[model samples]
Target chain A: MEFIQQVINGLAQGGIYSLIAIGWTTVYGVVGVMNWTHGEVYMLGAFCGFFLFTRLHLPFLAGLLISMVAGSLIAMAIDQFGYKPLRKIGMPRMAGFITALGLSTLLRYSSTALFTPDPQAYPANLLSYKLLTLFHINGKAITVSSLHLMIFLGTLVIMAALELFIRKTLTGKAMLAASQDMSTLELMGANPEKLIKITFAISGALGAAAGVFVGTIYAINTMMGSLAGLKGWSVAILGGVGNMTGSMLGGLLLGIAESLTAGFVSTGYKDAIGFIIMILVLLVKPTGLKGYSAEEKV
Target chain B: MLEVNDLHVYYGNIHALKGLSLHVAEGEIVSLIGANGAGKTTLLTAIMNQVPRAQGSVSFLGRPTAGMTTPMIVRSGMTMVPEGRRIFPRCSVLDNLLLGAYARKDKKSVRRDLEDIFTSYPRLAERRRQIAGTLSGGEQQMLSISRALMSRPRLMLLDEPSMGLSPIIVEQVFATIKTINEGGTTVLLVEQNANQALRVSHRGYVMETGEVVLEDSSANLMQNAQVKEAYLGS
Candidate 1:
């Protein structure tokens, strides 16, 4: 019963991790940049949600929508100002990586200075904290919070919509092709730059949604992005870098592992569990769970 | 028609194309034959504005394409079947074909053209749902060519379409190139297979070290002594 309870507890947090990892992988796959600032984008989104809820008193759904739009704009601005110039000058790959790191630092500190380093909480009544009882295993009832159910279901809907978009839409298919070869996409008469911007925008929206979810569950702080961003990268690596499905699965696995560690083992070791599994998975498969070896370019 | 005049392209310090000049008239199969590192690929990319031109001017259909982006060039009715068949390996064959028509806005004609392609190449139609990477090299080449054709290009640039194909497949590919030309799409073919390229082309240019060493009617170029000894292996 306790194990089942722990699993249930981990799922909502896992959903948030999945969103962040998907954002990271999508940016890496399409733009070929690590996008270290993504976590900061998530932080900014959390702050956006905070402002919307506390100041404007907008409803939760409206806050989520506004946060997502804000996240996309911020991400697109990062690409436009931070990375696009590097691309135009035909800079090396390392230059882009360094730029991402620098931008991440700048954004993190700027937010820290702007919002102050203190943690802020979402409204206690912003979401109903009603716990629904499922079944009694022994004498103890297994229960889930309504918020947790909402977060998990919301992630499922978003992922399903994303999958459908990739499969059914021309622009989405073009994005898939761009991941394969950007130059050839240009040969097909699709502007790769436009596709790249859209990719960043989508990635930003996902990250922001995850941020808002996390903010609702926990206190929001400028420092929150640092750890969350690293965990997201770890999830991306665990799932197989650049593979969307892998990131999704990896995020859930890490979340469950962490929750179980906290339940059965030391809670102090919960954060270490994800990285240890990632290292082990790398040692075994190198390509993560679903990552295929890159085919030699013909 | 495509016109390249004194086009100079550099890869960092390496002078890939040094003030080279070439042109393809409308309704003609013009072949540019060269050895490896002789700037054949650079010339094609430069024509499409994929590479920075150090000094040059490319005029397509009598308009200067000085600052046009590659996709803009493609949208203006020219596309390339790039070297080594750079098809989206993970995508389905049908998706690949659909992406080839990405820039086209006329949905009805695009659908009709897709049907036309399927009718012409039953093999592609058969494997439309299959992942492209699983296809044979010959099928991949065909898909690449068909992908270029999907753009409804007035001029098609082919870069070494026979690079890794078997001799029989190469022959079939050349035949398809001829068929495409007969269908009224002008072709700018770059090949190391000089003999076969000359056979299929209306005119041929021999490139050496980033400059045009010879240009003439295909029959005369085929009969030239230096061309016979250097490229034909006769």
Candidate 2:
């Protein structure tokens, strides 16, 4: 019952991790570049949500939507100006990864400079705090707040919609094929540049939405992105580097593991639990659980 | 119709396609046959704009495609069944086929053409739901060809379609290539399998280390003593 309670507590945060993991997984999948600044993008998104709702007096949902739009544009600009030029020069992929790391640092420090490194809170008066009693497990009434329900349900809805888009639409299927072999996808008449833009856009939008969800739940700060981004990438690696299904599972697993560790063991060890499980899984299977077979004919 | 004139493509300091030239007329099965490293693939990649050409002109339907990108070239109605049958191994067969038509605007007609493709390759229809990588090499090749065909291209470029296939499957692939040509899609195929490539193609260009050493009717080339010694075997 405590385990179940821990799982419930983890679900909201787990959903957030999985949402972020999908973003990191996608950008890596399409162009095979890790957008290192992905965490900063998440942070900026939180800031975007923070300002849009709190400053502009917009509704929470509306601010989240605008943040997605803004996040997507920001990511597209990063690709257009930063990575696309590197591609044109025919630089090695390692160069792109390095550039991304540099960009991550740039974005993080810039946000800190701009936002003054001060933590900000979402205005609580916007929404009333309401809790729902789910059930009584071992005489302890297990309950979830409206915000907790929102995060889990929101993540599920987004994921389900994304799955349907990938499975049912031509552009979506092209994304899957592009991830496998981008040149081949291009040779087949699909513009990889366009698909790449869409990939980053989708990734950024999710990151921003996750950002807003977090802001609503807890205070937001510039430093928050580092841990969130680390968790997202950890989840992505834990599931599989480029595998969508693996990333999702990896996020939930990390969340629950962290929660359970904090609940049963030392709270100080919660942060270490994710890395430990990732290492253990890597030892057992080099590819994450849902990762595809890496077969190349020489 | 497609034309490549005085083509020169380089991989760093190495000149892969050195002053090579070839042309394929409408409704012709043109094969570029050579040994490995003879620049057969490089010539095709240059034509498809996948590789940058140091100096040359590649025109499709009389439009100069110099500096054009792959998707742009493909959108202009030329698609390549690239070397290694680079099928989306993780994708389903149907999805792979659909990706071929990613640029087409005629949404309703795409459905009709898809049915047409399934009719031509019944084996593909049988495995439409199966993951592409799980299929045999020959099926993957078929999917690669069909995937290119889904674009409804005016011209198709196939690179080494028979490399690593069984003799019987090679026969089927060549026959399919012939059928594709007969159905009104011109073909510019690059292959190291000189004999079969020559047999199936209407005209053959023999490349010897980045130059077209011979260009003649396939039957004529098959009879050439030099060709017989170097490729066909006595």
Candidate 3:
């Protein structure tokens, strides 16, 4: 019963991680740049939702919608101002890495300045938590909350839609190809710049959605972005740097592992367990489970 | 028509293309033949704007191609089948073909071109659903050419289409290039296979260490003593 209970507890957290992980993976896959500010995007999004819902008295869905749009625009603006000029001059790749770190620092500290260093909670009555009993094992009932179900379902639907888009749509297919070989994609007449911007937009939107989840289930604080962003990048690496499906699964795996560690062992070991498992996975399968095989391209 | 005047390309300080000049008139099959590392691939890449030009001008159809992006170059009806048949390995054959038309806005004509390509290369039609990486070398080359054709290009740049293929496959590839040229698309081919290239092309330019050393009609170049001794293995 404890095991089943831990699994239920892990799913929503896993859902949020996967949303954040998608942001990291998609940007890395397309631009080959580590978006250190990714978690900040999520943090900003959560704050956006928090403000919209709390101050403006908007509906929950409306708040989410605003976050998605605002997050996407913010990400695109970063690309435009920060990376586009560098790309124009054929910037060395290390410069991009530094740019990401610099951007992350700037966003985090500025956000702290804007929102203050205190944690902000969602409205207590924002979401009604209806409990549902799954089944009784050994006279212990396994229960799930409405909020948890919403996160899980939302993650499932979003991931499914993303997968379909990549496989079926022309622009999505082009981005997948661009991820493989941007130069060849250029010869095929797809603009790498446009595709990358689109990638950032999608990634920021996912991060924003994850931000809303974290803000709702836990609490929003200025300090949340840096550590959460680091974890998101780790999840991306643990899955496979460029594989979207692997990141989703990796997120779930990390979530369950952390929950189990916190439940069965000590809360102190929870974060440590995720890194240990990721290192073990890397040791065994460096490419991650569903990673692209480095087969001959020609 | 394409004209590249006094082109210079540099790989760091290596200076891969040194004052190279070449041209391809409309409806002509032109081949650039050279030894390995003789700047043949670099020239094609420069024309497509893949590499920064140190000094040069590439004019296609009377317009300067200097500032155009590769996709913009393709949209203007000039496309290249890059060396080693750089097909999108994970994409389906159909998807590869669709992407070839990425710059063009004519959806109806693009679909019509797809059918024409399928009818022309039945092998490609059979494997249209298969991942491009799984195709055999010859089939992959064919798919590459077909994909370039889907752009409805007035001129196609083919780089080493015969690389790693058996002689039989090479013959078929050259035959297809010839046929495509006959069907009215101008061809600018780069090849190390001097014999086949000179035989198929209407004209040929011989390059040695980043410079075009010889240029003439293919028939005359085929019989030239220097060409026969150095390239044709007389």
lDDT of 2 by residue, B3-116 (tens): 889999999889888898888999999998888989888888888888888898989999999868898999999999999999999999999988888888898998998899
RMSD of each predicted structure: 1.6, 1.6, 1.8
Candidate with maximal lDDT: 1
CA lDDT for candidate 2: 0.89
Which 10 residues in a row give candidate 3 chain B its minimum summed lDDT? Answer: B98-107
Residue-level lDDT tens digits of model 2 in A156-240: 8888888898899988898888788888888987888889999999999989888988998899999888888988998998888
What are the lDDT figures for the candidates, one per model?
Answer: 0.93, 0.89, 0.90
Q: TM-score of the A chain in candidate 2?
A: 0.96
Q: Scoring model 2 with DockQ, what do you get?
A: 0.89
* TM-score for chain B of all predictions: 0.99, 0.98, 0.98
TM-score of each: 0.97, 0.97, 0.97
Could you tell me which residue pairs clash in candidate 2? none
lDDT of 2 at A89: 80
- Candidate 2 regions exceeding 4 Å error are A295-298
